[model samples]
Target: MSDFLVSRRFYAFAVAVLLLGAAWTIQSRVPLSDAAGGQLTSPREGFPAPEFTLEDFQGAPLASSSLRGQVVVINVWTSWCGPCRAEMPALERVYIAEKSRGLVVLGVNSTIQDNETDARGLARELGITFPLLLDRDGAVTSRYRVRALPTTFIVDRRGIIRSVMIGGPLAEAALRSKINALLAEP
Candidate 1:
């Protein structure tokens, strides 16, 4: 009967261990909330923006590394997103105003679930003359961790990510402010 007692105790211990392990696994999977935790800053901030080589609307190759010396504003967007559509004019204005000041606005069309024609139409309608990159399979979007439509990242001239704006219809004034700040950086 002592052996039986020992076996029962061991089984109980093993079960307890398994339950604790499972609890830990589940807790680790939960996303960290900004309020409950510390301020949740963009993962890319202070890090080099993930390099990617994607084709523009006209099939021209555009690589992130090639724009190293210029402050780059990368906007990940889809034509179907209302906020994305709304921010196009502001983005274009910022592009026009700051392009000569060493700023390049790259509109990355998240085309995995969008039609190429629709993306082109939106750009044309908005008179967006900035370089529009085509993210065909969402690889670039995923790399940037773009969780929402119209997310924008401001990259400094040294290729470090300076700021990230998510859920935009970003205003022209706000864009200019951010761009001016980045342009001022060496």
Candidate 2:
């Protein structure tokens, strides 16, 4: 009787593991959306990137929808993050080289966790030319589910998220390769 009980327990555990795995697989295949539009927006790859409109560092409104049909690199950062500071120049170089090829690099500063003055100062120090979109109220940051300071989302021309790099001083060479491949895609 004890042996049978032990075998039954083992079987139950195995079934639970299998069920969890199946659930994960299904969730990965189906992107979830939080909005009422059911647009499949998610921070995961193969999902539509979340739409946002924020004031640029210059106080002009910039909408993600306005960048349709262009490859976008959205880098969520804060001025105090060391990795964010380290990757700014690489991001700038990539933006400059690829903007003509339809690349738009948006440095999304989580201003609630940072300040505009420091963000501007860093941009000047690093010669960053990409638009710095400020998330003053933290809405954009929360929408992106940014758990780290330097998360980056690579969205293709169709606005589908192609890659998500979390916690990075992402290498310029790697960044270039990813962008080139996405830009090459139809």
Candidate 3:
């Protein structure tokens, strides 16, 4: 009887593991909005980037629509994310090098789990000059479908997303290349 009970327990555990694995596989294949009941759809290359209006850290309103006609690099990040911190310098370099060439790098802060003080501190520490917009409720982050910290989207002059990088402490060279490509586009 005890042997039968043990076998039953093992079978149940195995089934549970199999079910979890299946669910994970399915979730991986589907976009987050479809897999999870999220309202925001993930933006992709060649798609019109979702529009969003959020306040900069200074409380001034900034809108994506306002950035049309420029190559925009929108980076979704939080102060506490290690990779985000690591990538700030590279992002700053690209921003400074290309800003005059019509490149606009907007750092979108994930304010749902971050504070303005910390965001400001990080920006100061990194010496980031580009505008840092606060996504107070993570609305913009969700719209961008930024699953990981340091996700970046390169939007062309026409407002179409040209590249998406999720999870990074991206290299300056790579970022510069993407920015240059977008700048080269009409």
Candidate 4:
């Protein structure tokens, strides 16, 4: 009887541990909301964009907070990234076509993994005219949680992140469609 009781108690403890682990896993995966049931500010879609200021190649300081009323496209990339090179023209085209409509495409170089010379050269070569912000210390990259070379975050005019593109030689048509949809929004 003692042996059976001990075995039953051990099994119960094991089950409880497993259940707790499962519960924690599920909880951690779910997005957290504020006390008022509003979406918490984060770097993800439907959340307020994590703000940062960086110097453009011309050394002009541009802050994300300053772009509140404009639809902003934050592209995190390294100069050596092939997809970055490929998408540069498309991004530039979108910027030129939509700038008057309050579209701002910010090319944020992960300068921690790259250099100023190479980034500038690539920009010149690709004829990219949008502001190329340098993340010299990787602070902006860390804030945005950019794990990939060419991550793009599309923030709506109200400063909330509306979409996130992880990796791509993102097609011009698709990019334009997403931006146009957001631009159409109030």
| Best-fitting candidate, scored by lDDT | 2
How many pairs of residues collide in model 1?
0
The digit string of per-residue lDDT tens for model 2 on 122-172 reads: 988988899999999999999999999899999999999989999989999
Residue 54 C-alpha lDDT in model 2: 99
- Candidate 1, residue 31: the lDDT equals 71
| Displacement of the residue 105 alpha carbon in candidate 4, Å | 0.2
Q: Mark the 10 consecutive residues where model 4 has the least summed lDDT.
A: 30-39
Question: What overall lDDT goes with each candidate model?
Answer: 0.88, 0.92, 0.88, 0.90
Once superposed on the true structure, which residue ranges of model 2 sit more than 4 Å away at CA? 1-38
| Model 3 lDDT, residue 14, Cα | 80
Error of 2 at 115 (Å): 0.9
Q: After superposition, how far is residue 158 of candidate 4 from its true place, in Å?
A: 0.6
* Model 1: residues with Cα > 4 Å off, grouped in runs: 1-43
Weakest 10 consecutive residues, lDDT, candidate 1? 34-43
lDDT (tens digit, per residue) of candidate 4 on 38-149: 5457889888898889999999999989999999999998899999888888999899999999999999999999999999999888888889999999999998999887
* lDDT at position 89, candidate 3: 89
